[model samples]
Target: MKGWRAQPGRLAAIALLVALALFAIIKTDDVMRANALVAEEEAAMDGAAILASSLSSELDKFSLLPLALAEDPQVKALVAGDRDAARALDRRLETLASQSDAAAIYVMDAQGLTLAASNHALPTSFVNSNYAFRSYFREAMDKGSSTQFALGTVSRKPGLYIAARVGPSNAPSGVVAVKVEFDRTEENWRRATRGVYVTDREGVVLLTSEEAWRFHLTGSAPAAPRDPAEDLRQFGIAELPRLELPLAGASGEIVQVPLVEAQQAIGPAGWDIHLIVDPGPRVAAALATGRLVLVSIAVVVFAVIFALFAANRRRRAHEEAVVAQRTRTLREQLSQANRLATLGQISAGVNHEIGQPVSAIRVFAESGSKLVAAGETGQAAQNFSEIVSLADRIGAITSELRRFGRRQPGEKRIVAIGEIIDGALLLLRDRIHSHGRDIDLPEEDLRRVTVEAEHVRLEQVLVNLLQNALDATDFGGRIAIEIALLPDAVHLHVVDEGHGIPAASRDTLFHPFATSKDDGLGLGLVIAREIMRDLSGDLVFDANRQHTTFTMIIPRHR
Candidate 1:
């Protein structure tokens, strides 16, 4: 009789626990589903806002075209009744339309007769076509400028027409208009979302990623009945059918459908863009995650209670061993990463150092072959000697790069400034001669100045600066090397008269992998700067000048 009474108490406790567990699960599901829907809706809103911004940007980009074209001399002349200007204006508009990615560009008289168009050569050209009844034409003439989105009368394609009046505002001569299409924008939206559409103030869809939704009403019906003629002119249809999209409801409530919708205004044009997304996948994932977390907590609590009575010493020792092994593996990975990074730096240095000599050797070999064919034996022999010298220089560069990679100090010696400049110029002789660029060396007395540096490294730095100057200077331009003697250092400036370095590039001028040249490896300046620092000197850019200047400051050898 006592055991039966205890069973009833145990059963009551079990029922209480079961009720709490069920309540927790239900609450978790509700919270997860609500959060998932909110996230999906927010994401949809972001997408809609981006698409709206893009549409606004596209419209704004082409809006100024008509206004600028209205000021063109040819357009003005054509508007002044000069028939000869029509052919020229046609070609001009064609070129402008192609360059600006516009669907069409045309000029119309005050009476709305198309005088000239970009597609004049096409069979379906707008020339001689009348668009007097178009709202854009009438509004532009009266208000000085106007924009309207409508279906093309001839092509039947939809586009936004931007029009601007030509001549005085009081009495305009004609109007210039540019049409911009949104096929690309709609294609992009289709690739990004399930559904997207843009609606006018009247709730009629003007642009949509879904083809079936275009020219349809977003609401159950139009706010008011539209004139059949006006509807036909704007949308090529007398009436529009409502899309099956549902209106957004209050948030956090579970709905029958799994779709979330968001809308954003495109611009002041009273256009609204709607983006739809399916939240079923996110909601399912959240539910699965919540259940897994709840089940894991239950399992972990049971495990912890059981682990308190188990053998802990062995387990703790095993965990320590595992941790030690993991530490060793991570150390090995870090060491390997360090080795790879060092190897990459060395490779870049070798490539930059060897590039100039290899190019010189090729130029010399080509000249030598030509000289041999022309029976110029002495000149050919000289070219062969130069190629051999360049080959030896390449070998030296590889050894220097290895030392640089190892962080070993290069051998320093007293090198005259003149010799360094001469060496660099000799290496770039072919480039200078080919491009017809002038190099103005310092005075002969100043050339005798000496600096404490590694000869080859110093020569390499000069070569890099001179090469950059050569690339920047135009044909027949001048590059000057000026020497400024300081109390303890010598400042050698490589100045070029070509287009100066862009302001945007000055900050990252010496950063690795930052270059203005299309073919540049972006390592030359980095290596050059490092070499200067290694030699106990520094390289710096001088921006307070009319031309681009790079100054190399070195310790003067007494």
Candidate 2:
């Protein structure tokens, strides 16, 4: 204990070791949390894909069912109200329903009176009922074909209705309709460890694995014109609070079933099929991985501490005769070292700040050299002009570094998103042309879409996005840029035919120090996000589909 007190250096080293241990623990915990989130997002996307495929198959089986049934002779006769032929038509409809696995099949007259039905065997059958108020029957008679979802008046169960007109288009006799309940799909969801549902355009759950949630409206889905309590006898659903729906841009959306999950479009009824799974398993796996990482880091930290302690002990023996003068010198040297460290950090930041412009200069110079070799003197001269401009930019950056010190980069103006895109592509032109990569640019008229943003920061963000895309893509890969002039914002999308952003890294996508590359500082995206936010904008990623998509939204200036 006396020897330990004598060595202040060892104590300082031990403190550092403790700090490092705490840092490792905190970092690991953060990483595990991120990994768990990524796992959930991936699970949601996978579930949506599976649901979409299932729905596609299900729809393919019977998208044309009502059309074919509407053409049937017996169906036409049933719609014509032939009482004697109604029994034969009912038998024929029952066979079709059984064969197609449909919930029900019915023929309704022009006045919406049911003549025959597949479920005529059941007590609450539609054999001789009227459905004049149903939207499906009314829409089919008026538009030749229609699809809708509603609770059955007779069966009192929710189902989708696909209806097609019978007889001539000029003078249709009636409608042939099929009811689909997705019972098999719901049963499958219930058995599996996942939540699944289908919602109509009005955001009402027509079918769901959770029976209680069935026929309920999500906040986004449509609602009945009249309250359910007013017509309690019409449909058997109990009124419930609407669930929140968080939309995920154009391709998909997320539902908070107490957890985030994705939903995709399915069938002609404009139903969004959502799927989600238990997050427990993946979260546990991430925790286990983090524990292993922490253990490994702890071992290394302890080993480093041990080595430093042992060396300090050995040196203490060698300097047993040394005096307080060494301590004084040591303090002075430490102060100098701190100064140098500060300078080193500043130097690294300066390099990072200037790196993009330097790279662009090089790219332009090389392109110009090639043009000169090919006798394109006029173009080569234009490239030289860009070089001079970039040199002036470097000088300005250096001046700023010398005068104002380190600061964020952004100077907002009414800048065209197209100009930003053009600048970025101009920097990457040589690479794009050399690789013969296809680049889809927005229209020239699209340049009219103005966004108030810093020209440098916007170009920097775009360049970084494009460069990352180039790194991910192979030769001959395609890259597309699309611009949307939204009512409030100008949205820019940079799409790439690459493997996509990994699900594991999705949680920290825009966060600092999140990169797959060894040399990456992982600050490009982080800086880009800051720049956009500084200019009253946002940067988001959309990797829901096969490829990668980065969306940059900026406030539009008319």
Q: What tens digits encode model 1's per-residue C-alpha lDDT throughout 1-558?
A: 999989999999999989988998999999999998888888888888888898888888998899998898888888889888898889988998999999999999888888999989987699989887889998999988988889998778898889999988888999999888889988987787777888888888888877777898877345787898898888898977777656332233454556887899977677898887778778999999998999998888798677765668678889999998997576445333432443453354456557878999999999999999999999999999999998998876555445333432357888799988876665565567767988999999999998888776676677678877877888899999999999899999999998889999999989988988886657677767776786788899998988999999899997
Q: Evaluated with TM-score, which candidate comes out highest?
A: 1
The 10 consecutive residues of candidate 2 with the worst lDDT sum are 248-257
Task: Compose the digit string of candidate 2's lDDT tens values, residues 1-558.
Answer: 888887998889999988987888788877887778887988788878877788778876877999998888777766676678888888988998999999998888888888889999999799778887877777898889988777778777777788899988788899888888877777887887356777777777777777766766686754557466633433465564565444231223343223566878885557788875555567667878888877886688689778988899989977864655686465435333432333343455456546767998999999999999999999999999999988887786575334222223335678777777765665556466656787889899997677777775677667678878887888888899888778999889889997677789998988777889887767767766765675788998886756798888888886
The 0-to-1 C-alpha lDDT of every candidate, in the order given, reads: 0.82, 0.75
Error of 2 at 117 (Å): 1.7
Q: Looking at model 1, report the run of 10 residues with the lowest lDDT sum.
A: 400-409
| Per-residue lDDT value at 372 in model 2 | 100
